[model samples]
Target: MEARSRCRLPCSYYMTCKCCMKRMDGKGKSFIRRTLGSTGFVQAVGTKAGPNGTTLVSTGLSDLDKIIGGGIPLGGIIMIMEDIEAPHHLLLLRYFLAQGVVHGQPLLFASPLTSPKSFLGTLPGLTKGKDSKGNVDLQKSGQSADGLRIAWQYQRYLNEQKALETRRQRQQEIASQSWASGRLHASSLSPNLSSSVTSGSLEYTGTFDLRKSMDQAMLNAVNTVCFSLQGETDMAPLHGQCAAFVTTHSRSVQEVPNVGRIAMQSIYAPQSMHLFSEWKMLSFLAWLKGIIRTANVVGLVTFPASLLKPSVLVRLQHLADILLSVEAVSDDHKEMEAMLTDYQDISGLLHVHKLASINTQVPSFPEASTYSIKVSRRKEVVLEHLHLAPVDVYGKGSGNAGAAQVLCSTPANAPSSLDF
Candidate 1:
């Protein structure tokens, strides 16, 4: 019995023998074992590695991207609560689709409008040779010729020259510091690093011109699919389309990963609201959230929050990875005019409700929850921090100040005024 017991292998020996061999092999023939290279994961255009190793795709608006903590992550859904009175949500949808088109990413756009394809024609074109502020350099455009011809422009020209000289000196100092820090030498060693930096600086997120439509040739080159939700009786067909689209661009099917964008405009618009039940709509969102969570796709859905019940709206908000709401500012509102310094420039207010917290526990909070959205030069959409107008002590121009004083002043008939 002792001999038989000794000949038999121990229970742990059988269980750990292969693991031990693997550990030994791992230590000795490390070179033989394959390790994922830098190029192992294909990076799609318009996408960047974000915090916590998450992949981020630009929201098309650079300011919006900054506000939302870099960009929207892959496999995430961005829900924008629409302003019922105005078509402000379309501005966001257009930019999102246009950016995808610019990056050569596949786009699936669905809208409740009768002819969704016609909406593509309204997409903003990429502005070439524009600075980060989406402004063309006046000097480069020969607009300085008028200044040269005028006698009064001499002082202005001298001031401009002084400013240019100061800028040049500052740039030279920065370059010298970079060289001194050995960063210039390190950057020179990696050709791709320099190339990527140049490309990123130039075209990381395209600045779009709202006045110009995308070139026909450029639009034709892109693979775009548009769907009209006008006749759809239920959400099943649309859900299927989304699923199929996601499946086509899924990581498992692609040899090289390519990002896909799905934009749905006015999901709960009155025109299509009758076609879908509240539960059905909720299910569709839930299903979409599930499918996109596994695939290399990002989705944007804009819906009229005013049309939906509070409970349903809350559920929708919870499902969204990022939630944003737009409120149109009334031009005639004296209070608003008095409150904002740039009242004429402001078109609407953008509220950041929830930011995407994918693959992480910590949530991203913007420096300010609200930003003023306005058109710059009537060409580009600009988002700026809301700046309050200076308070007028005399209450001459400030309507809000006058109203506040009137409210604070107690009436003679009031009990509080009579006693204290």
Candidate 2:
């Protein structure tokens, strides 16, 4: 009988094939390596690295990262579409910048329209423990409400919970190191929605007050990559310049070895829109997308969907890997409350047009989520799924109504006394 041999791949050149890996030349090998390289310089921006090897990076909003796939992949672009009246999107931008600074990652903030400093000021001061708005004061220290002399049962329960939390946080610290030390994959959140680590996910290192001058070292680091540009029409050339600058920083042993994080903020603002013609804007983004995929770079851009025509925004949406739109909840608090009656609290609907690179291996990635950006004290900045009870009662209120009826069923009493 004749000896037979078979090759399974459609094409031997298909990357990742064992035979291909063996035969691959220097460039091919490098391509494969880069494809698998971890964006570990930054940690817990919300997403894990993909198997394809493109570096996964954080937006500096761990909450946002969790909602939008594993976090934005390096070489990926996020088009944050904000409302005309609402500036909540700016909060996310500040988080991104602050996150970069904290991680000591090289960041490029190019804003043709807004005052970079004023916008940067919006970043909230980093704190140790932040819970639901009302509960923050309670959980100020590691052991919240410590001053209160509570009963043993409740205290013991708290002790058990605290112990569990401590163990989880320890796990998070270990996991965070994986991403920081150039390991690509990470569990974005510990068992809880929030990260358990010390610094914690998306936590800013320090506060920035306009009254006080910025730190010398922090200022210098930001200055190295931040570009305050003029003459908006053609920024494609400037794109090349920025990429080169980032490359230089990443290679320099003197600077922190960080992955490049670029924030092309408000590119559609009036200051720069005229500079980029319809096709010119598209061309620039296309070039940008290519750069991020090949290099250790991830970009975040804000475009006012209101300013540009829908068609133009659609074109941009196509170019970007993820597109998020924010709308104001309502001017009237009562109106907002009435509108989102089912939810305990909701800021606005976070319409996510596209979400890619979901890590299915991780069970946290929900099959169906009513994604929203809630109005909370701490976790309010990014898009979060409106956390609801698994068994939604839908306002039936039978138990409460019965209790009320029992008390109120007595006939109307005189003003002096009513039935209890």
Best candidate, TM-score: 1
Q: TM-scores for all candidates?
A: 0.71, 0.60
lDDT over C-alpha atoms for residue 15 of model 2: 28
Query: What is the per-residue lDDT of model 2 for residues 27-104, given as tens digits with 9 covering 90 to 100?
Result: 334434553434232222332334444445667665676676456766678888878788767767776776665445
Report per-prediction Cα RMSD to one decimal: 15.7, 14.7
Overall lDDT per candidate, in order of appearance: 0.72, 0.53
Residue 137 of model 2 has an lDDT of 53
lDDT (Cα, 0-100) at 201 in candidate 2: 34
TM for candidate 2 is 0.60
* Candidate 2 residue pairs in clash (backbone atoms < 3 Å): 35-53, 36-53, 45-58, 47-70, 47-71, 75-292, 75-293, 233-275
Clashes of each: 0, 8
Stretches of model 2 off by over 4 angstroms after superposition: 1-48, 114-118, 128-219, 222-224, 229-233, 249-257, 333-337, 342-347, 358-370, 378-383, 387-420
